[model samples]
Target: MAARLTRWAIFSVAVSLIPLIFSFIYLTTVGPTPAFFDLISDGELLLISVALTGAAIGEVIDKKTARIKSRLASGGGCFLVASLSSSYFVVVSAQDDVRKEIVMGMSCALLLLGVISAGLAMAASEGEEGG
Candidate 1:
């Protein structure tokens, strides 16, 4: 689970950061634009990705002590928080309509992932109790 989550976190980090980096560079080189504002506003997602990746790293390094179900539950909760933040960005950021729609879709995807992770944690807990 730790490995899997770490992979997921890494992928998400790439997804969030790659565009951010390119956009930031473009903003710096080209001048002020809506993309720059979008980058500034959407920056929190990078932090969230880093934090979740850190949590996964901790689990991987401390495998002997970390509880799998708890880790999954917490990871799921973090995802929910991130999803909420993204949703807020969609509503608050004055980004273009197309980008706003993209953010909305990302929020929904995050919400789905959170629910799935939470469900997996619950299933794991049940298995532990039953056996």
Candidate 2:
């Protein structure tokens, strides 16, 4: 179950990055429109992903640092950074209502997957130690 969850989480993270990458590409090509700055100046779209990344690092990592735990935590951290940075363009380019909601939805979905991944990784690490 843990392995399954990890795979799902990884897949979810990968899926989540797709829109962000496209957003970056779109912004590079078209430049930021006026509507972009009007909606997301404070970066509210990324709040949950950032918070989840922090919780994963602060709550999961410990003195022992089991291999699975460390890897997943680090991977999540990396994804968090990539997601946030990429999302900047996403929010900037999302001039339309549909695009805005899609980006926000993906961000929240990534956050959910990150939390589940952290929990499952910890569980798997404990299983590793015991059996």
Candidate 3:
């Protein structure tokens, strides 16, 4: 189950890149369209966010102390970065200041959660190893 989850996570990450690559190709051939590019970038980032989240969840489910610690740390970190990037794009594209602020706040909260999860996973792993 763990291996399968890891494979799926990897596949999700790879698929997420497809939109950005296609968007680049479309831009090169058809010239620039900010709206279209923004749409594609946003979708790509969201996909990446989901992928990282899946990876982190998978690591937690696996529950192998040492492995879980490293995987959770890396996966959570990646998720946090992706969430921040998504929030930035959301802010840039959103017209309403109120909505933009709300989204940004939520994104920051998610990042904090990711950091906390990573730290806890590490501590749990250490406890398992030492006790």
Candidate 4:
């Protein structure tokens, strides 16, 4: 049970991060945009990483992934916070409109990722105690 839960938590991370990573790559390097490396490895990614860590903690801490997931099953603003911040940067910093959308979209995806992250953490924590 614990192992299954851990698998799910990791699966969640992989599942969520895939869009983020891909969109991030696509958005920042679709055209004659600035440096792709620069955009992808900037503050936005850093924020996502940190926030995801927190979210992961939240999920596993409760000793039951299902429990945390249940609480956040039908929630809002999953990626709104991250998207807003990322959008701001994308609009202001990204000159190309296409790239901007990609960046913004990536942020939005990451926002969702952040939301699920907490649940993952809670689930992991629950599994730790053999719950």
State the local distance difference test value for candidate 1.
0.49
User: Which 10 consecutive positions of candidate 2 have the poorest summed lDDT?
Assistant: 36-45
Predicted model with the maximum lDDT? 2
C-alpha lDDT of candidate 4 relative to the true structure: 0.51
Reference-based lDDT, residue 25, model 2: 66
lDDT of each: 0.49, 0.52, 0.50, 0.51
- Candidate 1 runs further than 4 Å off: 32-38, 42-83, 94-131
Q: Compared to the true structure, candidate 2 yields what TM-score?
A: 0.39
**Model 3 Cα displacement at 20 (Å)?**
1.1
Encode model 3's per-residue lDDT on 29-107: one tens digit a residue.
Answer: 7876545434343233443454455455555556655665565665566556556656655664564444544544554
Model 3 deviation from native, Cα RMSD in Å: 8.4
Superposed Cα deviation of residue 113, candidate 4 (Å) = 17
Off by over 4 Å in 4: 5-10, 32-36, 64-130
TM-score of each: 0.36, 0.39, 0.37, 0.36
Model 3: lowest-lDDT 10 consecutive positions: 122-131
- List, residue by residue over 20-125, the lDDT tens digit for candidate 4: 5677667667756445444554336535544555454444344343455543542223334444555655554555434544655665556556555444444434
Q: Is candidate 2 or candidate 4 better by TM-score?
A: 2
